[model samples]
Target: MVQYTPRWVGKQEESIHIAHIASVKIDTNLLLSNVLIETTGGANPIRCHGHHKADAVRMKALIERYQNDYYRGGGAPVGSAESTPAGR
Candidate 1:
């Protein structure tokens, strides 16, 4: 199951975030680490020598890592379009 938060933006209701946790396989022998992992979206399946079930703590850490990368990684600037004018 995934965890999500809801917030109110003006008069509209919105979801703040959605966090998901699942078991992932890591094949050290694989040339591409990402291929060794699996996600929900439509992606190419990869070989899995073994899998490790992630616990709550590990899931939390992974969520944090994902958030950090999405928000602060070496890519487009965060809040690029969310900023609002002082009077608006």
Candidate 2:
């Protein structure tokens, strides 16, 4: 899960699993970037801001890589909750 937790209380944390992520949009200025991650469901998108350009690019790349690896059944380690066993 990609979690974004706030420092202050009374605000709920945002978490979007790799499988649930539908799309990733990035807006960049000269110094900072904003990454908006929308989910497959109708839930609100995860909007993260104020990141370096390289960091923003790298974040998108990593998410896509993980998504591909997950679907290929090689990303999740064996005997972990994220990975299901064979034969139900």
Candidate 3:
């Protein structure tokens, strides 16, 4: 015996697809903190063997590139917590 399933005639048309883009909040303190933690020479981790100033400059550049990409790709607002609001 075969079970019959109702065919969907473009049923997904009514559904809304909301995209979530993770935005990076660039803070010097936080960047440096992460670099330090990762670079500590105890175990194998993402290590940065450079001066703080240099590392900061590099990270800042990276952050700017990411922000540009986000803006270009029509990313969601800079600080929206929920995936989607009830109404829209």
Best by TM-score: 2
Candidate 2: stretches off by over 4 Å: 74-88
The top-ranked prediction according to lDDT is 2
Root-mean-square deviation of candidate 3: 18.3
Across 1-88, the per-residue lDDT of candidate 1 in tens digits comes to 2323334653433222322222344443333232133345535433333323333335445645665655664432244343334323
Worst 10 residues of 3 by lDDT: 12-21
Off by over 4 Å in 1: 4-54, 74-88
Q: How accurate is candidate 1 locally (lDDT)?
A: 0.38
Query: What would the per-residue lDDT of candidate 3 be over residues 1-88, giving only the tens digit for each residue?
Result: 0112235653221211122212322234533523322212334433233336566566546545545655665654334442246423
Provide the overall lDDT of each model, using Cα atoms, as 2-decimal numbers: 0.38, 0.79, 0.37
> Looking at model 3, how many pairs of residues clash?
0
User: Which rank order by lDDT, best down to worst?
Assistant: 2, 1, 3
Residue 73 in candidate 1, Cα distance off native in Å: 3.5
Clashes of 1: 0
Summarize candidate 2's per-residue lDDT along 1-88 as a digit string, tens digits: 5565566765566666788889888999888999988899968878889999889899999888778878787667334466765523
> Which structure is stronger by TM-score: 1 or 2?
2
Sorted on TM-score, best first, the list reads 2, 3, 1
